[model samples]
Target: MSPSWEDESAAVIAQGLRRRGFLTAAGLAATAALVAGRPERAHAAVSGSRAMPYPFTLGIASGDPLSTAVVLWTRLAPSPFEVDGGMATDSFPVQWVVAEDASMATVVRRGTALAHAEYAHSVHVDVGGLRPDREYWYQFRCGPHLSGVGRTRTAPAPGAHLDHLDLVVASCQSLGAGWYHAWKDAASEPADLVYFAGDYIYEYATDATSVRWPYTPSLPADFTRQTDTLGRFRQQYGLYKSDPDLQEAHRVSPWMVTWDDHEVFNDYDAEDPSLYQLRANAYRAFWEHMPLRSPQRPSGYTARMYRQLDYGDLARFHVIDARQYKTGQLPGSTVGDTAERRDPSRQILGTAQEAWLLDSLGSGATTWDVMANTVLFSRLDSDDTAGERFSTGQWDAYQAAQQRVIDTVAAKDAGGFVVLTGDIHRNYHLNVLKDFEDPDSAVVGVEFAGTSISSGRDGGETDSGLEVRTRANPHLVSADLRRGYLRCRISHDVWTTQVRAIDRISTLDYRAWTSHTLVTEPRRPGLQVS
Candidate 1:
């Protein structure tokens, strides 16, 4: 039987209760038996092919880590088109192996999973019960094919003390606009983890015009570039995964991911199942291409990609799914007044996801709470005097829900909160406000919203509308329209985020420098700490 949120949550609670003897060990064992293990066919042994050859024909990738476990990913490409291209109709058995060394001499874990017809035969293996903060090398295997070598690291154990943690955060990568220079820089940065916050590939396919001017349309509206079909989604992943630079980044270190609008569509709602299927298909394609866990399989029209990963006691990573389970308001739904923005009825995170976030915050014991979520959670305005409202699609649109998250964390974790936001396609630093319109209200979190990887290229002068926006929102301390990522480093007491801006975009020589900086202190509420 498929698992429901409440059922899974109850199971987590039950495990905790069992540990405390509220429930018997025998009872817990029985429960485990009911919901344990992969399918029998997946575990059936592979006798031959000990000396597997030509690994990494496609590319390497990794994701979804915990203290002890992390998922490793790769696809076998006899031909990129045959495997991940979505053009082929056959299925292949993809094998995976994780080792302690770059060379496969010291093998630790090995398994075989089917690269199915629907998912373009990708492999996502959830490797569990391993050590924390340790590095591992992994590779994929097919009948006679091999994938490139990839590396991954598990998160630091919860409550363990450490001196430092480095993470690179980024989002909104449109394929047609430019090169992955931001990705190149991010890959080269000396960071322990790179959290791809969302929009790895746009759902739309562009044409020569989008390639030329506003030029990219994901294809023309009349021509229809990307397909809504499962096969098309698979092909989209293929196109994205085929990028050498992106693959190189995946090969370097572990990644934590969450999707935004473009992953599925501009605005999506979970309430409607059919449309939701498209999102699910997109999610499945993402999971297959990514290094997420295996059980992350899609159910009906949703995938459980949101979860927490702790890096010792330094930080707790909360990856959220802001797209799937949402009540998509109109495209540019920014409205006036907190009343419209704060309506409890208006949900950016559907009921279930909201509960999950609150519960994770309540139970987590990390020093820093870094939310790897999509969309700007801060109150931003493109116009101030123009008096245009906020987009109902952003976190600001669901004021009640965002406030609940802040209040929950504040009441529980007095250690301060740090949110890493994306999807606006522009860089911004905001002093997070529990009630944005009302400054007298609590200052709950500090946000570092990164610019896109070539998404918005209004590379002219500062937008006049933004000046009005700055004039209106006191919480917004800074904003920049560029394409780049944020390099954030955390020590025991201080947290620093350096927004590195690409000097020029869509070019290989685009230089980057620390465009801005923000510091956060323990127990302090917002971004004001210097």
Candidate 2:
């Protein structure tokens, strides 16, 4: 009973979170009144309703952006696989709206926020004054049911710069391995954010070569594909948010997620104390279905997912959190390029997130410095004749913590250091070497690994181990295996990346293409073939 965020102090929680301005709206209504008044601990259970039901299934979302503010979300789960989702320990009130025209006809803000069944009836809502590189449009109501109209944006007025930044770097999907049409063509592009980078949900289930339709419904024989407790990880994120192409790409854009190794377990680490209450129920169901804010919610197994999001002077996103203070992987080598897996006190982004990512890549006030990485940070040498067998679950098992981020991007000559990766499921285009066993090393930046939306089930558009893994790794430069996503287009010189493939994820008629585009310049550090 001593943990309601156990007596603060991390310097009074970073000086009361630097005077609460993050995710604004009064710091998410003071974290929804500290998780709806705790209810004598064990959070997730609240009551005081006035009758309600059609609780906007798991739809709408928006996240962590801030030039002004943004953090809307939803989850009253009207029977989202029962247990507690079919809500009852009540407390609805919900009502949110934040238009700037999408036929929402101009109103700017609206609020009400408190759909707590402790937290399962989720509802973040950090919205603020807005208008900082704007493009709003939001929705949610809870008693006249109206939840689907999302599209968010805001984050480019900080240092104010010039021109593009259309992101969309996805990750592993795995809902029985197919169908989401690359998240419905990245939610009909016109993108302006969506980094993702993790497996999103896949604590193992649907085997026997399943292949679709909510994994062919008919569960509850104590259904288990290894999701230990917390009501089977909130019924596996209410069956992957009951996919409507991943809830229409979280209802059209505005995401910046993080989390890998199937959200928990697949590679579990957090200095395991017998899986610390299964990483506090997988970080409280990944902060009750992410649209994160309130300093990345989850306080039980400590969840302060690495932060940083600036687009003003044109990019500065350090969003790293490589498996919550990583340390395991190095035993029977499931991908650990040995040599004691390059141990420099073995750790990945851990020591205070590698000193807040080398003080935000040596604070070179943005001109591109992206790094929303999850796994794979360059070198994938299987037999490049040297770095001996790589992989140990990425950054080739922390080679001196990936060479202290390539010697701090070569001693802060930073020069636009891009690195948006995702766990290995396909697509590549490497060239991030400041060492990788030096094959004339010193290319120091560029990595674009994305390729998985619908894990690896229907792949193939060139693969037979891609010409011996790009001829024993010559900094790879193109290697696709199918199912897609990865479309960046930053400007102020160049950063074009467009792999975007999708010949099939097993029907739903979503045939996309563009199988290879690359390009890098901005102080040039490799990769090009536009």
Candidate 3:
């Protein structure tokens, strides 16, 4: 996967990922994949161009959840999700405001929105009344440009019992796989909200294992589209919305995203062909460059991505969709094959997002129940490691709907549960036991599972029998495959967590302490990492 990553482009792979990050996201994602993957690049970027430019040049974001209000995204760059930064800014009808005072002089909400370069001109409002857990500041405009002021907060009152929360949980990044400096050390820690939980960018069909920093962009980079075009899915979502450390970690924080399968590729399966027409152009370029949720808008290739978010009583996230409703990869799973990796009716969140996570955990209000889904929900018996052996991508290939969601949250009494997760690169901490056929019936929940902030496994050279398969998975408590991420400090009776990591992902003066912490308590049971 090297020969100059065959057909590379997207401004020379985001200027070599702005200059090295973490083994450049799987060595430049095997060279930004897809030389028409042996004949797939035809749809000719679905025509209809010309339009872009206004108060959107890749900036603004915020996604804190439940304490209510916080989901402000912006796009309209038309040239940064992958390509085509040419024309059309829908005659500039963009204006968005929110503030606890970032100098808008006491403004709390302002209007006028429209960055429609056919979605490439992104804009995800979801503002909502505000005042739940304070600390806000925002920006966005068009007529004379404005964006570049973001900081978000709200979510400290579903049961109110706060003392601390500072969160963070990232996942596979890839825009050339490097220099997000683990999101610049999670925007210098002291977090408030960051749960990315998915491979943000990676649609390129073939870049031949991009040998150490080399996918010279000019075509589409990684938006994936040899055919089924819509201007090559807005030029691969304007090359990952022109990365500026994923736009300064989405301008600092207010994110709770959940898309896993490289946003729209890896392990995909809406109906089949494992990425049916590249999942209709990566779901219309992932709701046209993030900040989504007007019901997952994206007209060209259809996108409805499931939803859920809450964090006031301290957590109730339960977010899922595991790549647009599943039901694939399990039919004779490959790689290292452990009898096709323990396939018990293989699935990953299907059956209506698993009955909306059992009616959102039987309609609970909040006091901790987070699951912000995307691969790795614990119980990894990863045999020879690869595919299967538990992991048809995640929730252990939906084993009878993940044991009916761990036997109905260990037959209910539920309260401070935790799942978190992100694809398997490394870093775990489990205790979520609950009758994997009773080796001891209840332990209930808790499962951090992060790692891979500049993405890819460098964990000092893999196989340590995978750190003894995380103590042979009896509700693992530690697995440090290494890389970094997963902060959680919450409190109100131990939320603790740590697993930060960073002797180096790139650097922003990082020291990122607490390589392990765990804790968990509230609806009480197993989990204690320290």
Candidate 4:
């Protein structure tokens, strides 16, 4: 008899895995059982004693924190490099517990979640009914196997008075570029929350000259190619998450994450309908790997990520999605001052998002309004000559959209407006002006653009063209080419930002230091560099 369609599809997948040198005898058996759709085999895989390998190799994480709820994440991946994470085609029950202490003696919340094979055996438990502004320790348990413990906390209650809030902003970590020493350092810092602006995983092929090579069990064949399919993207995520240092950062604090271009493609936009399938695959993989809630899950190629997070009356976080709704860049140039660049119709954030942002800012709900943006929010002049030049990928490309935001903030008299940005792989402090053409214009707010975690390899304190670039743009206060993150402290009266820089990233053991410290006050916009 001819093979059924499902059998053929399974055969093709198995052959691809064999070609990639990832399919073992046990993996082949698992794939065949999944294709056969035998409930008996699926049931035995989870029920029989010692029938399945130990899962939960990817570690545990918590994200999307609320005053009374937090999402806990874990995956059943004994052999994570495999397409299905080396699990039987079945759903397994995973028990989770939240405690008030590290020992877990004082349990607060306990529940069970199903880890489904369709979603790579990943589990997301949205634990609620917890106390506000309290710390919790959580862990997961599979059949005879226990996952690591993770620490998390809830946000301050609404209208609650907060003396201060410490946050760490980080982004752009390329696994092949360098070591994750910066993440290790970030894990050690005292922070209330961690905001990962973008670039959680790069969709690039493996680097032949990777500093950390000969990975345990070797990298899958898919790593040799750029990620465009769901399986490949999943493997890429598995590879990055295998890093102990990055895992430590996630285990230490609850992360608020968004995506940038590298997560799918370099400088990709939603204007092209033909790439919808690719986007769908990437988006699905992203959702499966992240500790996101049901609402953030993707439907086909679209997902709504723009939302607001408030920390009492102290501050409000407006996390924006810049890449998904962005239009394609102007043809033939990436940096310029062309007429079309200034067109009002050219939008970076779509009309709906723009309106949402404006309305939220106009509400004036908190002492500080912070935009957790993914790109440089201030105009950056790259050309040293008399002619002005700007990166079209940044806010400079959509002057009208940027102007609308500025106008809203100014008109609404927003108490303390600040933009925390990442991307560009460098640190920058800019005085956001009402007019970029005139340096003497009123400074409506300030922008603290952070450097990468480990994207551009080892960098120095200053780049070759720093002096010229600084001279061209007077709004620029300082620029440092390094690998580190921004440590920010927000209070009712003052907001302090420390430009943290690491000594090196090519090597594992490196030192970190503060390159600059800047402060801004409520109702006052410009930075006072200390």
Tens digits of per-residue lDDT for model 1, 340-389? 56668878777887888888874556677777778888777656564647
TM-score, every prediction: 0.82, 0.35, 0.34, 0.89
Q: Model-by-model lDDT, in order?
A: 0.67, 0.74, 0.61, 0.79
Candidate 1 Cα misplacement greater than 4 A, ranges: 1-57, 81-91, 143-145, 210-224, 330-332, 386-388, 440-442, 458-461, 528-530
Candidate 4: stretches off by over 4 Å: 1-49, 214-217, 362-364
Best by lDDT: 4
Q: Which whole-number lDDT from 0 to 100 does residue 181 have in model 4?
A: 78
The most accurate candidate by TM-score is 4
How far is 391's C-alpha from truth in model 3 (Å)?
5.6
TM-score of 4: 0.89
Question: Residue 148, candidate 1: how far off, in angstroms?
Answer: 2.4
Instruction: Name the lDDT of candidate 4.
Output: 0.79
Pairs that clash in candidate 2: 335-391, 335-392, 336-392
Q: Which digits, one per residue and each the tens of the lDDT, describe model 2 over residues 279-386?
A: 888888888888998878878877878988888887888998898887877765445455677878889777888888987884847778888897888777665454
Ranked by TM-score, the better of candidates 3 and 4 is 4
Ten residues in sequence with the least summed lDDT for candidate 1:
37-46
Rank by TM-score, descending?
4, 1, 2, 3
Candidate 1 vs 3: which has more TM-score: 1
